[model samples]
Target: MLTITNVTWLDLLCLTGVGVYLVKQVLIKKNPAPYPPGPRGWPLIGNVLDMPRIKPWLTFAEWGQKYGDITHIEVLGRHIIVLNSTKTALKMMDSKSTFYSGRPVIPMVGELVGWKDSLPFLPYGDRFRQQRKNLHRVIGSRAAADVYNEIEEVETRRFLKRVLAKPDQLQEHIRHTAGAIILCISHGYEVKENNDPFIDLADRAVFNLSQATVLGAFMVDILPFMVKVPVWFHGAGFKRTARKWRETLEEMVSAPHKLVKDQMVAGTAPVSFTSTLLEGSHVSAEEDHAVKWSAFSLYAGGADATVSATYSFFLAMTLFPDVQKKAQAEIDAVVGPDRLPTFADRDSLPYTEALVKEVLRWNVVVPTGFAHCVTEDDIHDGYYIPKGTLIMPNIWFMLNDSRTYANPEQFNPERFLAKNGKEPETEPRTMCFGFGRRICPGVSNSHQLTNSLHLANAAIWISIAMSLAAFDISKVVENGVEITPEVEPLPGTISHPKPFKCSISPRSATVLELIEQDANHLVHDNTL
Candidate 1:
């Protein structure tokens, strides 16, 4: 039935069909990777619209629930992987640290903060390792512990004074004392009272840093190509703000460095982080100056973290009297009313230790923490994570995960205590600093020593001195309405409560004398 033209058409059709089948098989073999489960979203803007601008931590947690422990999403062509479980975070971010330790290049933090040089935000490479080595040499766990006596002395005295004189501004006092201690150690400066130069500078620096990291700033980071367009033509406010922040931060950080260096040359400098850097620079002056920004990174990082934690401690004490009573009782039973607790007593004070962990869990200061970027391709649970993926270990969710803690909502210290009231069981809370190889290197010694010796006991003493002794830290109610704690914290990578009122008083005559004596002996360091 076929004619000459029909015979040719039949031959062409058979060849075309064979070609199609071969191409399909080749494509399948070339790309046989699987992605983690995630909510389906439009191309080039996956889940961006769904993400909450503020409190993205809560939103991320919800997504983790909808998706599995490891969820993948795309924002403006960039891939992000959120680690919801501790096991996965530790396994990938820790065990395979070389791949997950680098930080994402956020425009606000990187461009504005000179992050090409900032240690915390720097990528995982030789430069980062060098900077981290410097930090370890100067303020590593062991060295941090060594510096605790000064931290304890300064913070403790300030707490005692605040309990005796100004209770309303206790929050500021606590913040100032903790901040000033880090400032002094980092730059050889102490803020004895309000309006100290160092304190003012640090406050402004934090504000600018926070403003640069808020949700608004991320708009530019998410769409960096917009930044390539002329500011006058495209007309976005991101460029202007980014420039201002860079200049402000440089001025704030550079001025202090110059002042400290000058003081050292003029023979008036005390032992400080800057001084240590300078001394070490003599061995490798060129390299050290190149990474001098690392020193400022420590100041900025250590200052705010400690301050945030202490402020939360105050809030916790104000809200939960029973928690305070138990901690104070432990402090009293171990050290008695005559003397203060120290780092040596940490093992003996199990309840106090539990309270510190509970505070960290209750109000997570750095909820999402700083973002970490994947350096290479990796696999977790049969899914492929490509290189350059932004890995966020959902620290807030891990701490509050109901599966781990019995009642995650309430601020209960007893959760960390032993069930039978014996020596206590395994600590329920995980590391608040971070996980794996990148876990906060400062934690083991300097940070821990400072908290254990002065800050922790200082908070307990302040709680006992003010709440138990003078003021009632119970909730305030007015006009037939119970006023919940007003914590309109300045939005940033970190947060603290807004100012509120709480009653203050002295518990007894014996306690009152000890407070007064302690305050008198703690001299204003400026006049020293």
Candidate 2:
């Protein structure tokens, strides 16, 4: 019925094409589910300006209160899905792991700093699976409990000696202890001093990586093409920084690996993760590459996280003197003051064990836990989640969920205790380590003990029990005034208590004598 004589045939064809495109768009919109609700943002920027650079987890948690458990936001058109509840995270990240375990590509952290090789940032694929297998074979929960038990005990004793000698440098001593343990297990290398060069290099590299991966920290991360800009160009300092970071990262990954290889050739290699993997008869060059990077991954992030948790334990003790007193009382009743607490005393010291779990919950390390990306488009609870969407489990929110724990902000270990005053029925490891395939490989190795109270938690549990039995972490007294330590933690991916002053003193002369005896025995045994 339309008259086409007034218009050219080409123009009519164009009009018809436009009509078809509009109809298709409408059909497509009607077919797909809607994205999860989030704060509306302007076009193009898409919540980029609204994203908090520091302690973003808090913001996400607050948003979860307004929105549902699953909240979606976009940063410069990149889809971000935050899981605020344990149930949702478990369902999505754990039950549907295959479709949700991919790691988002961070140009600055992955491409520039060379962290793409690390297992934590590696994409979900065959290589990632192989690396995980190798890591689990060495440091998995069962393996860590079996092989590293005695080593953890010796290292804990050495750590006590360092703390006894320099109580003022408690955090430093904790760092040294964690570094020593990981170095020994990963490369069969001993960290003889707190200032070991390898430790220094690893620390610097991790710091750089953490800074680079902060959301919205680097422009190039969002605008990947900016990486092509010359280093000399104005505002291209990020390029220069990345180059320097690459050097440190390369050394962190390769230096210790080369050392192990050299020792293997010289017939002096110790039985370590690297040596075991390298000595295997069927190991290929590809497998060697996987092992090398996998081992370094253990050494790179392990020490810092351990140190952070330890510091949090100290901070908790300082703030809650009553909690400290209760834990110490339990340790005394179970282990007695004759010797330091050991793995053998774990079962008898239920309250002390509860304290360790509480510390992990109080100030979660890696709050918005390592982001997992989706491998394909999926519908979750009627909400459409497109492929490559970044999925972050709000660990802090889950740990502090008021529905799960009453008075969530208070530092209380009693929440974990069973109604009958027995061991905790439910451990917090699920929330602490993470969910599904992307869960921390070191979860079982990092914490959580078998019924035997093995080495997995020996470093932290023993240190905590022994320290409580030996020292009183009280408010610092300057002159006659008591300076209350602040309980607030610093905002970061791995949060630690802000610098706080507290007095660490032996409980009594008898306790000091016991500490001295233990130190003498460690030195006599050449364990330190």
Candidate 3:
């Protein structure tokens, strides 16, 4: 009887183990929803080899055409969802923003290079909200137009002078102008020259950060366990690079902020974004920290983006002289040649306004809208999207959709104009800025002021109008040969036209005189 009981007990234990295995299998098969269709990739690597190192957006756009608006792929176990259509992006990133606002953890850029504090890469959480709130408080659409208009105007006038002095270095002048504007507004520290230390450090930091963020650039980003390896270990060059980058990033964030605080203490700080935040009523330590990083974030990307758009404008002007002529005509009729274009003149130049929209759409600054992360498992259009998926909105694909804009590839501003020859009822702000809660906080300020018709648009608009009003951009003539400018843009997250030669000359001696007059007499109230 004892032997029989022992055998029975052993059998029962074996049966129990089998029962658990069967139950697990059932659970796994219960919710087997199909993943969104994508190009067939290798087993293990799973599209890792298929990813493009440069201009990945172009490939993603092509895939969107083949696989549909919502395409999914995997790279070494990580899920990536590309939203190709504006309608789908709005539905997911806009309508269900809460679930899609989370940012993916970029080990190389965010963790190694120490950019986690930057608002752009911050994950969806209380800290992100705090940083964003502080950013909006200082530079929000309403506050920017009211507070930073003078600085923008003064810097832009300086820009005109720089371009007038050296027409060949138009790109350099635009970059310097962008840097100067952000520096003045953010730190109350004027950029004395094009090679200001602050600007140099910031530029270096941005360049390194951009390179690091490129997918597949660093092996550790794909296999995060490699982060545990020592810097002295073999094949660990990225670790040393990250260390140097971190130091530069820290100085970029802290140095200017410290200067503003020191100036405030000396009672000589200029009225600026940092000054306002630091001197605000009843500020706590946490809030002050938030403000410092938020201000740094603004200075970091603001100039780069503005520079790219302006460069595109120059490219557009060179390629399409007709657009330039019409725009100049409009600017002359509204502001005239005596004075440069101003924010108040924005409304009067409808064609100029349409040109701004066209520039944004023609070659978007960020073709792939910054990636967002999924916080929880979700399903859309009968496709399964697991939690922690990386979401990339293909802004290039959506902007170039032929259905939405007729002849999308053509650089025509009339697409944004109505039948009545006025601004269209619906503009493509979403394509330019992004979607949902993670949308660019600076979009409002970048485009225009709130509820102000005088300045239908913001700094870029004023700069473009004034540029057209003042200068005639045409093809460069070398040895009696008209060098046709190529409109091909460099490949990166923030793209600009490849270096092209163009002849930029004042429309008239009167325009040059006006630029000089404004440059000399523009009063900058640096006093707080």
lDDT of each: 0.63, 0.77, 0.78
Q: Flag clash pairs in model 3.
A: none
Better lDDT candidate (2, 3): 3
Candidate 3, overall lDDT? 0.78
Q: For model 1, what is the error of residue 489's alpha carbon versus the real structure, in angstroms, after optimal superposition? A: 6.1
Model 3 C-alpha lDDT per residue in residues 230-347, reported as the tens digit of each score: 8876667899999999999999999999999889889998887789877858878888788889888776546777777888899899999999999988888888668888877867
Count of backbone collisions in candidate 1:
11
Clashing pairs in 2: none
237-265, model 1: which lDDT tens digit per residue? 56776676677677767777788888978
Q: In candidate 3, which residue ranges exceed 4 Å CA deviation?
A: 1-32, 280-283, 420-426, 445-457, 518-520, 525-528
Looking at model 3, residue 230 earns an lDDT score of 85
User: What TM-score fits each model?
Assistant: 0.83, 0.89, 0.90
Q: Which runs of model 1 end up more than 4 angstroms from their true locations?
A: 1-31, 214-216, 230-234, 280-285, 421-429, 445-472, 476-483, 486-490, 518-528
Task: Identify the candidate with maximal lDDT.
Answer: 3
Q: Lowest summed-lDDT stretch of 10 residues in model 1?
A: 452-461
lDDT of 2 by residue, 232-328 (tens): 7656789899999999999988899999999998999888888888885877789889999988877654666777778888888888989998888
